[model samples]
Target: MKLRFGLQARFLVAMALVLLVVLVMLGVLLQRQRLVERESEALSSDVIHQLVDGYLHGQGRELATRLADNLANPLYYSDLDAIGSILRDQKRDDLVQYLMVFDTAGHLVHDGSAEIEGYGQPMGDPLAAAATAAAGPHVQATAQVLEVSAPIRVGSERIGGVRIGLSMAVAHRFEQRNAERLRGRIDELSQRHQGWLALMLLALLAVLVAAAWYVQRLLVRPIRQLAASARRIEAGDYSVQDHGDTRNDELGDLVRAFDRMSESVARHDRDVRRMAYTDALTGLTNRLAFRESLDHRLMLLRGSGRQLALLFADIDDFKRVNDTLGHEAGDEALLQFANRIREAVEKYGGDDALLARFGGDEFVILIQEGDVRASATRLAEVLVAELRRPLDIHERQVFLGTSIGITLFPEDASSATALMKNGDIAMYQAKVAGKNGFRFYSRAMDHAVERRVHMEQELRGAWERGELSVVYQPVCRTSDGRVVGAEALLRWQHPMLGTIAPSVFIDVAEQSGLIEQIGPRVLHAACTEAVRWMQLGEGEKLFVSVNVSPRELRRGDLPEVVAECLRETGLPASSLHLELTETSVISDELQAAALLARLHSTGVKVWLDDFGTGFSGLSHLRRVPVDGVKIDRSFVADLQRDPDDLALTTAIIAMAHSLGITVVAEGVEKESQYNLLAERGCDLVQGYWLSHPVSASEFTHLLARRMR
Candidate 1:
């Protein structure tokens, strides 16, 4: 029959071997203990003697060095009384046998005596030569004494030396006493160790027997249960339970903790999944979840002759609301907008439709069940109308509108990424045509988007390539038709595209954050050109008007930028005019007013450009600190025939003059328009009838002509 060596049996065998080894080791240890103790006593005596000798030497050296430093000044001054006093003080120590001071010539000056018997006598000791020659404390031991010598120096020159001798009698007695004590301790320890060994053998045997039983009953059984539970958890089973362990021990605590951890993991898994797929603000599907669903639907609809529509919606002028009000109001607006969109989608879109908040102020919807185009169109229309309704935010009614773009699957695009791109392009087309409407994706829209992207890329480095230049349009006194100043206009002549208009590239620059860089360059160029025109005018004060973008004004650096330009170009501040539109100032009237006030302090003029085109109210004129207003071309185009245009123009000039603001009419192409503006007391006029925008050199010629 085969015998099984279970845990208890193996433990018993191991314990027996250990007990046997312990008995043999104890016997051997007892036998060798006496010899080791005898040898240890002799070795300890030697070590103690050596340690005592070294300590005497170190003490002698330290005393000699201290004596040398004290005697230096007294020896230099030849004060024998001070030297004798220092030696006597050092000799008070019990270990110090003698102390002496020597001159550089090796003569003993003081030997710790009142009579100074060795004074001015040559040192006859063998160590005298080494003491005088050494730079630091030196020690040597003899049969009865330890001798130390140290040099005394004033600055870098050695003038004398000090010597000290310590007696060996006290050190020898101390060594002998320590050796006797050490022997007594060894004898006592040997007896105690023998008794401890016997007791340990008995205690170890008892513990081994008890451990075997404990392992079989408590440790092994609990460990096996824990291992089974771990295996279950590894196999995706999180339902863990404690097996009724009543012991208040680490094992019991671990079992309870494991159960809690399993429950926590299950709850966290659900929370993580929800957070990954849902938008926290709107409770709608997020972009990741929407994209995943779109891809899955596309796979199922493949080769099934079915279609799907993806619509992209963006809130129009949403940033304006955020900038004017706070983000809390913006969040409230978004929540309300989302609720309205959800209602509209439920009404128009079929059951299979999915809606998602793609990102900030942008939402996307997918419809795959019904007629894709018809359903998307109805949904887009309903969304636009419903969103246009005023929303109550912060107890104030705020109106919002949405622009949506629609693209169909298997026709406009096949993949999710491509469909999304086409939808975005179509949405931008709607904004460009006029916001608050919808547009369907077409090939032409894609091309237009490509061109715009291309233009933006090219505009980045156009200035470095020398493709940009400035043109000047002369502003003449309407009463005399004589040039007084010019408006600096930026023009870009692309290498491939002949001449790109400011309207096209200016918007691209602003959108791409390139205007902040380009705005300063234009300011500097205009100031530099105006200085030249001032020289050409022969003492006439000719000003240059530079257009400031709304983005640049919002940055609140216009005052500093203008000051820097004037400083660089040496242009007088009064000779530079900065032009801003009403829309730019109306966005943040307080900020604009402050910026304009700062510019006015520097003597630079601020003009409200494109007036009557936006917020043409008397309150705007009162709030903004403008020095002048420019009548937009739309008002000037029909100034000759249209009664309303003429009346509005007349009223604008009268209102501006009443407030001490000058009026300049733009787009005066006909003689009749100039005559009417001149009659209306317009201060300045610039249009095709007077002269087209010309190069700087050409404008210089006109200035010279006016000078003649």
Candidate 2:
């Protein structure tokens, strides 16, 4: 309990003890003060004895003679007056302050008053209890006065008593005179000790307050903070800083220990949360967190009947950044990519924006409000611009870019995962169109994409299921309208989705790596179908042509693929032709050249399909050994209406003939176009002007009909 009361209380207790001692000392001094008066009585007795001796030596014979002469005529108090006069004239200061004379009956004769003050006014009280009839002087203190009395004898007559009624003035005056001298001595001592007590008191008080402050800071305040911090930390909050500071004291040590503890708790809490919901290095939301936020917002939007939009972004050449600049730079680029996404989100109002970095260079944002989300193209455009800017770090500038896809809620899907899937599909379209662009999700695109996906799955099942078929489109001569060759086009009569477009399904098959199987199937079928015409002697100088995509050409197995097909079908190499588009030749020029050389060496002709239709280099044309060029239908179809088409057609025919390359004009719908092509010395043509894309039986029947 004493410890709890603290130091200040202890100080107050100590002060009370000091005051009690002062009061006790004052009581002792007041009790001792009465003794000084007894000493004064002894002193007065000596004074009176000296006066009697003077009188006995006839020291004042003249005063006695004068007094006797005045009293002879019957003045009773004359002698008393004469004696008082004699005593007053002597200047006996202490002895004569109070004078009282008594006749033998002890009645007052000449008592002194304060008008004659000090020792001359009064001495001591008479007829009081402490005074007795002793031969010496006696002193008493009465209610009224201090009393001193002595025997007064005139020649043994014992005429009266000599008494003094003394006032306190005399005793006080004596004390004051002595005390003045004592005060001078005390002043001297005090000068020697100036500022000592007050300075000590101030210094003691300052020390106590400083000690209290130190205790509060190092222990009390820190303990309070530790309590508060513990509560916050317990509540899974790590943001508050512990304000207690360390010192070279025990309490300070304890406080430091607590700070370290709080730091540990906070770090562990953050790490746990991050492990659950955050990407460690990039500090973005992980797949799980993204799904959670996405699901929650999607549900909210569904309930409120509000729109939610999502944008998915993929960086162009992201693998190259990882491959060329190293993985560290790749990670930094991803960070920068995320930051750019965040900036774009800020414009859309971050409250409705749920921006998160997905795996690699992929990212997603969920938009809650329609105003900002209504135009995802604008947001994607901003993202594209921002992402393409240069990132300067460590004095090195690096360029990065992104392709974005936007999928709107309900237009795409109502669910989070569905929205994300739609965005992914749109992103693929963007990538296909070329990198560094943006595409919006659409129902038509989705259906088109879904058809392709179904076809891809069917193509995967093609070899096992036997669902692939080939139809022949004949290549005929423009001049005589005679069949030169028949090109094979593979078609899939899908079991579920009927007649999926070749444009939609072929690319999907290639991406799914089923083209290798499908390509040979078409080649083998075309060869088998066309071989009957030659063996039966039904047609002359006719060959089967098959288009090879880039996937097949890059396999370096075109020669092997053709050899395998020829071995299986028992067809001559002269009766076989292979067609390729401009992209197939341009993407892998040298490989296409070498592969075409081997195919040409085998006596199988090669044709360029859709010439002047793509961004292909003319240099690939000379390199890759090929026999013929087929003008795109677009050029031929517009030849009558467009002068530029006529010029382009004329230039292409001239260039093909100069290279010993045969030219096949694709669209010959009008007699004027045919006449123009024949005049230009175009080698061959295939269109309604001569014949349409025909089935193998139709072409064979036409050949039989034309034999006449």
Q: State the C-alpha lDDT per candidate.
A: 0.85, 0.68
How big is the positional error of residue 568 in model 2, measured in Å on the Cα after superposition? Answer: 3.2
lDDT (Cα, 0-100) at 672 in candidate 1? 88
Candidate 2 lDDT tens digits, 157-270: 444455454444554555465555555655555544444544655665676567667656645567667777888877978887866574787767877787888788788887
> Which 10-residue window of candidate 1 scores lowest in summed lDDT?
583-592
**Clashing pairs counted in every model:** 0, 15
**Model 2, which residues run further than 4 Å from truth?**
1-307, 313-370, 380-405, 410-414, 425-468, 492-501, 504-513, 536-540, 554-556, 588-603, 617-626, 704-708
Candidate 1 Cα misplacement greater than 4 A, ranges: 1-256, 317-333, 385-402, 538-540, 615-618, 640-642
Report the lDDT tens digits of candidate 1 across residue range 431-468: 87778899999999988988999999999989889999
Best by lDDT: 1
Estimate the lDDT of model 1. 0.85
